[model samples]
Target: MRRPVTRRVLAALAATATGAAICVAVTTPQASAAVGSATGFATRNGGTTGGAGGQTVRATTGTQIHAALCNRASSSTPIIIQVEGTINHGNTTRVSGSSCNTAADVIELKQISNVTILGVGNGALFDQIGIHIREASNIIIQNVTVRNVKKSGSPISNGGDAIGMEANVRNVWVDHVTLEASGGESEGFDGLFDMKNNTQYVTLSYSILRNSGRGGLIGSSESDLSNDFVTFHHNLYENLDSRVPLLRGGTAHIYNNHYVNIRESGINSRAGGRAKVDNNYFRNSKDVLGTFYTNQAGYWQVSGNTFDNVTWSSRSSDNNPAGPNPTSNTSISIPYPYSLDAASCVPNIVSQTAGANKGIRTSNGSCATQNPTSGPTPGPTGNPTPTPSQPSGTNLSIGAGSDGSSKASGTSYGDVRDGNMSTAWSPSGATGQISIKWDTATRVSRINIREASGSVGNVRAWRVLNHDTGAVLATGSSAGVITFTATSLRKITFEITSSSGTPRVAEFETYAS
Candidate 1:
């Protein structure tokens, strides 16, 4: 929603050009002149030039200044555009000229690649993005400050993107850039760049983005699932109203970044096919990170990430009943929120299960019930068998049996652990045999199951019930241990039942391959 500054208005300003002429002229210094011809621009303190195409034209406005550079010859030859002083436009101020037409904007990158638009030592500021890229690639926009971009049309429109990159650009590098937005109703859109569609191999690093809407840094997919391969690292994000950093889709690597004072989530990965996230820091945020609602089974490796004062939540649309669970396994090793100091720093491991339960456990107790006969039962065609009901606080132990020999029980389907615990089948009311179907072929060897209870009738019998064929695997009574081996299916469930009187089981622990 950025307004275009027309060439006709610049032509009018050129006609009234007066004062010191701050023309963008390239000059080689004596030292560098001997080494090579250095490229740059020379301009007066505060003045304007006219004309739109010539290398030496004057215009009274920043828009005109930008137009002059756009009209330069040789797209491969880098042009040096300089800002004389500050150009004020209402509440907005710019280092160079502002405004662009569709034709004029496209002309800026007609055939350019290695272009470097350096800012003045004091840097430049604009109400909107300083430069917007379209159908351009291998570009580097560095050492610049872009601030206070106006929202597009309204709150709903796509506006205030600091640098908008569209139309299949590639191999771009944005470094050492600073973007700040005034925190109000006018939220900043994309910070360094807003990319979509077939844009690949881009890198955004060593930048500071603060107070942006939607995302501080974003890579999006507009329908066809753009194959974006972006890398974001060593950046600092502060006061982002929404998700500070995000990977919308494709392959992305996010690492070593710091997020502070975030409102919603620190980092969000939505609809992305595959991503690798590691070694990042999230401080004082509502939820530290999230991955949700991907059409395909998305794969994410979250490792060695640190979170202080962070909250976590998860919800998914996949009708698996077990919920969309993310695995940290052994690679996630960040400290919990309650253990960190005000400014503590901790290392993030790649495969540690530190925050695995942050999104899964809503409340502390189990929601299991025992129905003797009457209850809403599942349809015969797709329903699992009925499991037994047990009370709470049941204690079951596992060790060498009365004969001082180990007994084997339970079955493993695919790679998943099902029906290994005494209470697993009780909550689901699955009676009879318990079967497992693995999504893929898997090899599992060892298994362990334990039930904990206080009194005699408080202990119930437990067994593995396969929902597929309605068959029970290993059955046991009272509080005891069971061990066995079996292959696991991709998806399966466990079944439990009362052996004698209804027993109270406090915990059901299972260890399996």
Candidate 2:
């Protein structure tokens, strides 16, 4: 059974989508601010809020990571560890403590709860080392890279998996990370991300797993069926041999991911594993989806997926490819809310936002990045207009072209300049921008913004900018006559920086006073 949803997930969606900081904790040497909110299955089981409002520390080596955990007041005490520089076997050692179960040559998060490991500054790289999570809950690992970890080599760690979770793990989120290997198990490498032994309520987002034989697995074997409720979205899987991943049992929601160059197989859902596959992009792959290697008969509910140049094998006891022409074989009911990008745009979006050291950027659910402005601007303090009166002068926006960073469904960019109060434009999220453009440069000192009927008091803060020069024209708290020094510009943008609700703009009028 699925867990209940809470208000924390909604708050995270609002804050991160609006480019507002979801402050985990801020201390010297590291800023514990999350780049994006938790989505997918992680929003379940009371939501994943790792180390929020907890003590923050900094770490430069793997041993320091263990030390921070060992130094915590208790195993379940919330703590955020901001990591930087390279962490390898040379600097990692087991630290014995009541709060930690760490080991040498690896970053171990064992028997712990409410902890966060975040990469900061030049970023954290686990070179030839892996992260092992065992019997842990409510943990997060973000903005880090783990590469070339091996199990059978001279320098082995985490049994060769880049990141492995097992033994009753729950509510863990791993985001904006990169896990890669030199080759496969024959080359001393293993799965990039693996979960087994009753693991549940986990999410892996905005990550890249490449150049490995196995991407990951849900269960250790066909009978290890207790693991379930995993989500994989906005990830890139490239140059993988097979098992991307080999799902043995339980349910997985895989969407908006880009898969390229699969040598043998992809998404080997078998042993009764069920996957809800949606809006994914597969290019140059072989047997991208199906029940492979096992006859246990896994099921899939496929929709909106694009298979470009993906090859399929004949249906047999060992190979059952879903494609050649894929269709849904089962139905799944997802519990949480989410936005899906078009399959055509998955590659572009994942390439820019996935992996580490990418400034922790995320999609605004509308295929646009949230941070388009130069820097953070202060919130508006001007008094609000309870009811904005229509301006008298000629509305310059009536005939101008209109565009925006993003728009809500059933709303249009043209609605803000349409001159009809009944029709309006609303952003996909709490904050967004709407701009008016002209064929030639236009000059105006005064502008009036009229909010839509039901959304009058929704807008809390706003800024008018000269879109041509990226200059702020005026800052205010409400929709009304906003005045600044008369300047000529080809385009002007009215950006809603913060809002109490989903604000809507009925009309944007410009006048020369």
Candidate 3:
């Protein structure tokens, strides 16, 4: 359920800041109190009064308030900047572009320490980025919603990330905040929150990210200066569907989050860093799991998670572990009649020799054990259809082109690359009365179909064409494009039979759709 940010909460925030100002004015010594509350500022509604702690300057615009606050001093005893009303910047106010220029309206904490910038609930809309902390320490940005922040100005380029904490900044906490629609132009949104370059001890929790091109949180280091000890817990990431990579980092804890309707992998671990991904629910993802680089010294523990109606391979290998029994505690549960590649599930631990070795003890369970009140049995061609099981190390080649080029028969329909191209399956024919074969390649989730001939009748059913065995693993009458989970990577063949009582054979395509 979505939480509402009410006006009453905003009123309370204003009241709290006011109360703090009164207490600081009365308790501190005359000299110290003067330094704290020196400036006598007026409210946004235009009332002038000398507040105890610094100037209580209220600005209607977030940009105006941020500029005023950034102009403060670097004293050890910093002034508190209390904000009232929504500060809309960048695209939040439907501005010209996606992001606010960092140079124009950025709040830089230069050589400043022991400061708090408090905002009313939805009081400040850090449009481009809520706050940018660089070369400073002991900073806190709480109860803020940073939306529509772009890293770069170019619309074509993938820049303008929402929040950036660069350089030697330490002891930073971004809590009770929301980062959404930040990253990617072709996808939903485009931007990234980069916490890099020796930036350590950062905690981002209780946030919501939706319709973003990238994942909710990204912690990485371009330099080798060890960006570590970041925790991402109790956040929601949904509808982050884009081609760009999401969640790339090293040495972090990602737990207790809800991920829904992501076009790409739900959570990704790239680089050589170690991460603990556990206690999360991933539902309706284009691809569930992926690893750009694994098998390093650090540990990647994926345990105690639930997956429902996920697509493609749940996990992939970028780099496998080198030691004996390095990976551990990973499990998955799917509906009945759903099968996964056994080889992909095996831990990538290296033995003494240079061969592939298993490292972790993984388990699988059925959803029926938990959901007793589940619906009726699925049909044969439904999500839980049976798949053919094959041994490991099988060679399967999938090709998509306009020409009718059969890899198995060595026949070319025409210029295989030209014409209205569609993805085609090789070695067409059904082995038994089934729709798919499994256990050949590492993974098979979905297939993209291409219609070469304008007539679309050339393709009959979305069948799993096996090249090595020269048989069809599975056959489904559903036309256009079809996606199913298979155990292995076997060469898939599409049966291009005449659908309109004519010899209709055009270019058909298939991929992990």
Q: Name the TM-score of candidate 3.
A: 0.45
Poorly placed runs, candidate 1 (over 4 Å): 1-22, 29-61, 80-111, 153-158, 184-192, 216-224, 293-297, 318-513
Q: What TM-score, computed on C-alpha atoms, does each candidate reach?
A: 0.48, 0.68, 0.45
lDDT (CA) per prediction = 0.40, 0.80, 0.40
Candidate 2 vs candidate 3: which has greater lDDT?
Answer: 2
- Tens-place lDDT per residue, model 1, 118-168, is 334333444343356666555554445666655543322124566666666
What TM-score, to 2 decimals, does candidate 2 have? 0.68
What candidate 3 gets wrong by more than 4 Å, as runs, is 1-59, 67-76, 88-102, 128-130, 152-159, 187-189, 216-225, 242-249, 286-288, 293-298, 312-513
Give the top-scoring candidate (lDDT).
2
**Could you give candidate 2's per-residue lDDT for residues 1-513 as a string of tens digits?**
423222221111112223442222224221232545678898899998777656666677777788778767799988777788899988777766788888887899999998888887767899999999999998888889999999996798889999999999999999989899999999999899999999999999988898899999999998899999999998889889988778988999999998887889999899889999999988778999999888798999999998877888888877889988899899999999988888877765665567766555566677644442211111122322212234567889989999999999999999988889999999999999999889999988778877775454356578899999998887754455677878899899999998754688898888775
Off by over 4 Å in 2: 1-33, 372-513
